[model samples]
Target: MAERILIVDDAAFMRMMVKDILTKNGYEIAGEAENGQQAVDMYQEQKPDLVTLDITMPEKDGIQALKEIKGKDPEANIIMCSAMGQQAMVVDAIQAGAKDFIVKPFQADRVIEAIQKALS
Candidate 1:
């Protein structure tokens, strides 16, 4: 079966972009969340094989959600997504146990590469 991935991003367009890439690449999208809180909630419910979590969001940021999810599932495969120049936040995300990260204005190859690396 294709790996199931949960995509979390504040921007609908961002989520759509990721969804498009994943679907075309033969990955299954478990769900989509508009913010970190929803990401956490959906994560618990879906137990997807991987997650692409956006760093900046309303309700809860990706770092906070990443920590929470890691706390619950130490093995949760998570990849942080951030815009360019958010190096500090990305560092925090890596420290918090995110397997990898991808930058926005999504590059299909990089995004796929990160997800593949994390899942592997």
Candidate 2:
């Protein structure tokens, strides 16, 4: 079965871009979130196989949401997304239990590779 994925990004364009890439590659989009708060809520409701989370967002940032999700499901699989130059945030995300991190202006292959690696 195709992996179910939740995409969390404040920007509508970014979410659309990710959804387009994953859907074209046969991954199922479980849902989309405009902020980290929504991401956490959707996570509980959908329990998708994976999550693509943006590092910066209103209400809650990716790192905080990641922690919340991990707290709820210790085995949750999450791939954090950040723009270039957010190395510190990336490190924190990894330390906080995110399975992987992807930089923005996302390359479809890289995104897929990260998700596959995280799942493995």
Candidate 3:
């Protein structure tokens, strides 16, 4: 079965980009969220195999959402999404239990590689 993924991003365009990339690569989209708060809510409701989370968002950041999800499901597979020069946030995400991360303006191969590595 295709792995289910929850896509979380504040921007509609970003979400669409990710969804396009993921679906084309044979991954099922379990759900989508526009902010960190929504992300946490969707995490519990959908319980997708993996999550692609944006670092900066309204109502709560990715790191905070990641923590909340992890608190609920320690085995959750979360991949933080960041932009250039957000190394500090990325590190925080890693320390907070994210399985891996993807940078924005995403490359199809890099995103797939990260997801594969995380799943493996």
Candidate 4:
């Protein structure tokens, strides 16, 4: 079965971009969330194979969500997404147990590479 990925981003455009890339690459989309709270909630419900979590969002930020999710499922596969100059949060996310991270204005190859690396 194709790996199911939960995509979390505040921008609908960003979510759509990621969904396009993943679907084209043959991955399944388990769900999409626009905020950290929804990301956390959906994670519990979907139990997807992986997650692409955006760093900045309303309600809560990605690092917090990453920590929360990691607290619940240490083995959960999560990849952080961020725009440029959010290096500090990216570091925090990595420390919090995100499997990897992809920068915004995402390159399809890089996105696929990160997901593949995380899933592997």
Candidate 3 lDDT, 1-120, residue by residue in tens: 999999999999999999999999999999999999999999899989999999999999999999999999999999999999999999999999998888888999999999999888
Global CA lDDT computed for model 1: 0.97
Question: Tens-digit lDDT track for model 1 on 1-120?
Answer: 999999999999999999999999999999999999999999999999999999999999999999999999999999999999999999999999999999988999999999999998
Q: Backbone clashes per model, in order?
A: 0, 0, 0, 0
Q: Candidate 2 has which clashing residue pairs, if any?
A: none
Question: Candidate 4 at residue 45, lDDT?
Answer: 100
Q: After superposition, how far is residue 23 of candidate 3 from its true place, in Å?
A: 0.6
lDDT of 4 by residue, 72-107 (tens): 999999999999999999999999999999999999
Tens digits of per-residue lDDT for model 2, 1-120: 999999999999999999999999999999999999999999999999999999999999999999999999999999999999999999999999999999989999999899999988
Q: What TM-score does model 3 achieve against the real structure?
A: 0.98
Better candidate number, 2 or 3, judged by lDDT:
2
Looking at model 4, residue 33 earns an lDDT score of 100
Task: Quantify all predictions' global Cα lDDT against the true fold.
Answer: 0.97, 0.96, 0.95, 0.97
For model 4, the stretches where C-alpha displacement exceeds 4 angstroms are none
lDDT of 3: 0.95
Give residue 118's lDDT in candidate 2 (0 to 100).
93
Model 2 weakest lDDT span, ten residues long: 111-120
Clashing pairs in 1: none
